[model samples]
Target chain A: MCRPLCWTYASGVLAVLAARTDDTNPLSGLVVADRPEPDVPEGWRLVRVKAAALNHHDLWSLRGVGLRSDELPRILGMDAAGVDEDGNPVVVHAVIADPDAGRGDEVNDPRRSLLSERYDGTFAEHLVVPARNLLPKPDALDDVEAACLPTAWLTAYRMLLRSGARPGDTILVQGAGGGVSTAAIVLAGAMGFRVWVATRDAERGRRAANLGADAVFDRGERLPERVDAVLDSVGAATWGHSLRAVRPGGTVVVCGATSGDPSPVELNRIFYQQIRIVGVTMGSRDELAGLLAFCAARNIRPVIDRVLPLHQAIEGFAALEAGDVFGKIVFTIP
Target chain B: MCRPLCWTYASGVLAVLAARTDDTNPLSGLVVADRPEPDVPEGWRLVRVKAAALNHHDLWSLRGVGLRSDELPRILGMDAAGVDEDGNPVVVHAVIADPDAGRGDEVNDPRRSLLSERYDGTFAEHLVVPARNLLPKPDALDDVEAACLPTAWLTAYRMLLRSGARPGDTILVQGAGGGVSTAAIVLAGAMGFRVWVATRDAERGRRAANLGADAVFDRGERLPERVDAVLDSVGAATWGHSLRAVRPGGTVVVCGATSGDPSPVELNRIFYQQIRIVGVTMGSRDELAGLLAFCAARNIRPVIDRVLPLHQAIEGFAALEAGDVFGKIVFTIP
Candidate 1:
């Protein structure tokens, strides 16, 4: 449908783009195409991306949740690990915001935007970002594993830190096998928390146990004992259960609402039981740096579901949209 | 309906009691009658009540919200100041709970009950409580003012302490003239916070100003700027406003839902903005002590609307039910 000029590597670089959009079928708009290499603005650096990971954000972008119709052909990715022009390996911190605007915590910035929302993203063989966006990737992790740390893993790490649960405390993670939830299970175990997973899928529960959850429960099942905090990404489907699963004066830390928001939230139960509901998004740049150091120090490796060549990014998106991934899906750039 | 035998001072003490329940007309069950003076159990001390304060809890008790039918004729009061057996002037810590059960914070105990809920309360000539429940009343405060601190003032103090807002930061107190809200206005100012009040009544707004509120807004009005935290006890009527009034990463501290619980809680807004919703009941014994010391040191006085003889307790309940109060209503014992 295009002149060959659009695909010529001499003038463009290979990348995945959300060329169009479909609310019901997000994959329809996904395109494996070519895009001009990003320019390095002043105070920015160009990175040759060695690997990238797919996330729910990509599918949501295709469905126009955060992307606009006019922004079609935008590169589609948020997590990447690569070599900078100076040859240092780095992982990009996806959030783009002025640290001062958020009073030193960039996540609180009102004008904050993710990589793919307002600018070219990391899906391409070459990408440009403000120089401050890069954190040194630990030598212990390969490109694929480092690529998994920026978005989901960083979010999961921050959730646990915000949960206010000390070591030896118990936490209930609602929803299993999702990127953030799975990361929380593994990271919480490493952080010395007693991790409990609740999922409707028995297979996913088993997989979560394999990743080090101390206990697993059927979704909405009453816990054997109340936890000190709960991490809920399942939202409407698991909100009530999360509320009831925590002890009085306990906390429920929420990061996402994948199942939709619950109606008629039980404010009575929230106040009567003296519960706390804390929300988190992706962590700050300093937190991401801390995550990388912690993982390297602890010898933690990200769970990779599968890796595909960059040209096969469409298959990766399909698997993610179909809810078929148990861990991160990586695209290795050739 | 009682014989003269029930009225003898030697046989019984004069008290306000909930003899029955009527949900729609709560005042119907309120009875000014005679009840036997409480017997001191082991480890319990009896106090001759000099003053007691009225709260919405008294009305709710009359409606049988906490008092069961089998517990009818229950004495109804939670806040009291009086002379203990040792002739020491003391204030009762209304929360009757074992510190061991809640890891030293009695408010977190599942079996915790307020004075009027599980035991005969202070709207009588004498009351009994665990010996540990007494704290010395500051000589600077009279019996009436000390009586106002335990139930509502302590709750407001704890709510502000838990709000996570630092001194010089702004806080919005929703529903301005209720006991907790009024106490928050006065205490927040003394605690060095910029207190903004939201109220439906303009008169209450002006009165809040006289009590040290830095600013006032009509209920649900858009704030000039988002606050660092919001104190919300209005619940359904003000929940949405409370959510919107705070900045991202800010807190909304809740203690009661006097206007009924909000429906369709905005979980999406909560998570997306990284807001924190904290629920609080009454404070702990230690926190109550801290509140007393702070109020004394800061020269903070509870705003008293009126002081009436204990025999006029029914009139006080009627005023509370009719929403005709600006501050605390204290009943002095004969």
Candidate 2:
């Protein structure tokens, strides 16, 4: 699964760049072209990308959410697996933050950013990241499988850990087709939790069952029993149901709001029921390491929607933008 | 100030009862009249009330929110200090639910009801409660002060304990004059937290500062700095401000929503900033015990607005309903 550190092709390499941003049509900015090899700063290492995965974050970047215009032509991708400069197989921890600034919790760093948001990213033959951001890739997971672990999968993994649900407790994952929801279903099942999914699409609901959801309900359907926690990425659309689905003293772990923000924040139900709503973003570097180890130890493999070569990265981004990806979309670099 | 358990008053006793309910004029339901002395059920003990405290919950009960029309003519107090049949000075823990039902946390019990909801309450000459619901009242706190703790003060104590803010960290308490808010300010300061208050009235804001608030700001004013957490009971009125006042990864602990339920639950800000909203209600019996010990050890006294004889309980309820009270309004039983 490891690729050589690309010492021969140092000048130019195939990469996907957010050449320009369009708020409505994020994929219009996706360009699959050649990029100059990145410069490794002090304490940074270059890794030759073996496989990179697409994320909603990539679409958001092209829509100018976190990526600024001045930082345009930025390479796109937050997750990857490859070989580091020292020829060690590694998986990239996408968050670039000063741990000291956040008092050792990188996610709390105000200036924390993902790979492509601040630097050239993993959707290339080669990319550079802080040396500390590399975790040893377990041999059990192939490059494409390991590549899917950093962004959506890592977010889901951390959400579950922080969800306050015990292994035997039940958790409701809202939405089924998104990358984070799919990953949460599989990981939560493997982690010994009873996974229940709520999705509008019946087909996706069935797939969720195959992916390890113990029960599947129509989106907004009243659950037969309240869950111990709810993992929610579809915000406003499912927020009410999420709140209603959790038992008293249960938690709602949120990573993203893809459907839009819910309003009339029901403070009454929250205070009366003693519900805990915990917000989570991408996980920490240590958490990512733990995720990789957990996946390897459990013999868990990420559900890849499709795999494409780096030159065909635009199609991957297009599929993700169209909400057509059921799981992860990976781009392998030859 | 322990009242003797009057064995002579076996037939009738003076009590403030909600004879009826009024949504607009809750005071219309108030009746200070004679009621038969409560019969102690199995495992229940009689506590001759010395002093009882008023809470907003009393107002809600009068308005028939939790008190049903069928359950009307119920007693109206939740906080009390008195002498048990064994002549020990004790503070009542108002929550009455089967410990087994809530798994030892009465607040989480689905059928949990306060003292006045299902049984006789403290605003009377004598009341009956489960024997386990009494704690030895600290001699350092007089009956009126101890009476205040079992309701608003205990609620505030629990909220701060569960707030996730460290001793040196700052907490923003929304509203300054209410029982919970006033208690939060005083207790938070005594617990080593820097207490910041938000209030609509300048006089009340000044009063809050006098009661241990480190700073006070106009309601909805932008804070100069984000706090580690926000204690919000103001609900819809301060919900948005509460969200914005907290630092990233900070918390907002909500106990009630007096102003109204905030609309637009702001799922975006909640998940994006990684804000945590923890809902808390009244403390458990253990927590009430802890509050007593903390107060006794720290020489903290609950703020009392005014004390009236139980015969004149209507005035106290009126003051609370009018929001003319700054802290607790206690009614002493003769």
Candidate 3:
């Protein structure tokens, strides 16, 4: 049992903890606390966190979706860019699974869990993770940019890079301004894919175009032509468009359906045209390494919406919950 | 114009033609008639009919769904096995497209059409097809068995084989009685996959088990454990079970939604667990050739529900339309 580890900083650590879980108002449980540092577990290393990105996942945890109240009074950040005790700057791969049991793919392991789900995550001044989860941070990206790569960026990597898309193929990214959508836009462009974006917000569409999108469309606008693939994160709102925009034998890769699942499954259209709908989550450590190398090689930097002091993480969560931010909201652990 | 090419026996040809199209009463248009024999076009050869399989496509043609009234009175068989001009047994490939135009996949060719779409189809006395579309029928399968391979069998092949299933992977086929479902049961067993079937009809379930299904369940019955992949064709009725039956990272492969598309696309479960929904159409000629070779080598034969004489073609179609047949229905031409 978690015995009120807050306000009694035995080993001197400050963290953004979930004091309680409130599904109706997720942020109601937000608390900044001073807690004892986590002991380095077997085969794990303690990392001094430099930056941690705030994802919708943090809010979900606060809402007790993946995090339980018994596990509450727990820390809440999943993506972190930090320096290990060895003083090497690194990015953390959040998935924790035994590689040998999963044929070298931790994502396929059924019992796998991510940080902030079953353990105290990286919101603290120092956090512990399996040593294998650490990858050298690219020099081209700072700590906050590297912080965004683990969850949202890696998910987009697995969805786009592994969707069997070649360099010259055209892919459509549905929903602009969201972390995964914008990340896909940048990654697709850098990887030589012809990228397009759709959004209700014209300002976000213009920003996506400036990020190298070939074209931008109003939400539900007609595509110039059918594309080879579509990346959808906005669920009910854009799912129909994602299904309709791909060419015959093309694919629709999904990571999150944030808007919620839409009605009328569109089975006839899927079968008649021969489309593929692939679901992706956070990628493997090997993939994360590749993403780092690719970012370093291509000089790609993740887009950051805003960064706030660790003690002021509530402002970050409030911005994310309000849905006013364009990209990732990172917390600087001070 | 079709010009009512019906009974008069003017040119000594026997065929099942769509005399008219009626949405409410499709069978009224289905007519077994005597018409002018097919003339061999350039680069095409006359294949003296031996056996032709009855499929839902013919019923659809009669219902004005792909075949229009202007295209009515057109002969309507899609899968045929017969002797070519050289007097060698051959199975006709129904799809017609330039492989070079679609990266060696005609299914990707935007304007590609299947037999009975733009040209006269296989249900006729000495139907003619492009020489390239003919693959020598295997010695192992008789005319009736070979006739079932092109449409139902080939579509099942594409769905299961291309669904990325490895030998010994557990896959659940949702329906039990349809041509594709039975074909999947046999093919998956032959390929070393652990196959299961779910059927509402107890007799069909017993038949499916006899065809080598590892296990059988009542329609929508709870599975013992989630499987690696699910094959769905009974759309609205089984779509929910399909989504629920697959493990995280498992796939839901579909070829046809015979039951109509269902509502509430289940976006939450899909994104949360990372499931794949793949849509498959008919197989390619190369894939068909491989299937034929596999069947011949494996000593596998298509299961026939019944075989009727060419003049009694209506009985075969009626059985198919009524959904009373558990396997393929073939019509033999004397």
How high is each candidate's TM-score?
0.95, 0.94, 0.94
Model 2, range B202-293, lDDT digits (tens) per residue?
99999998998999999999999889999999999999899999987899999998898898777777876788999998989999999999
Best by TM-score: 1
Tens-digit lDDT track for model 2 on A1-334?
Answer: 1111222234688888888888987777777777776788999999999999988888888889888999988888999999998899999999998887665678878788889988888888888999999999999999999999999999999999999888899999999998899999999999999999999999999999998899999999988888899999998899889989988888999988887778868877888788999999888899998999899999999998999988777777767766787999999987
Candidate 3's residue-wise lDDT over A104-129, tens digit each?
56787778889988878988899999
Sorted by TM-score (best first), the order is: 1, 3, 2
DockQ of each: 0.71, 0.68, 0.70
* DockQ of predicted candidate 2: 0.68
How well does candidate 1 score on lDDT at residue A66? 86
Give the number of colliding residue pairs in candidate 2.
Answer: 7
* Better candidate number, 2 or 3, judged by lDDT: 2
Off by over 4 Å in 3: A1-12, B1-9
Model 2 reaches what TM-score against the true structure?
Answer: 0.94
Q: On residues B1-334, what C-alpha lDDT tens digit does candidate 1 reach at each position?
A: 1211133456788888887888988887877877876889999999999999999888889887888999887889999999999899999999999898885678889899999888998899999999989999999899999999998999999999999999999999997778899999999999899999999999999999999899999999998899999999888999999999999889999988888878767887897788999998889999999999998998889988899999888778888888899889999997
| Docking quality tier of model 2 | medium
| lDDT of each residue in A230-276, candidate 1, tens digit only | 99987899999999999988999998887888876788788778899
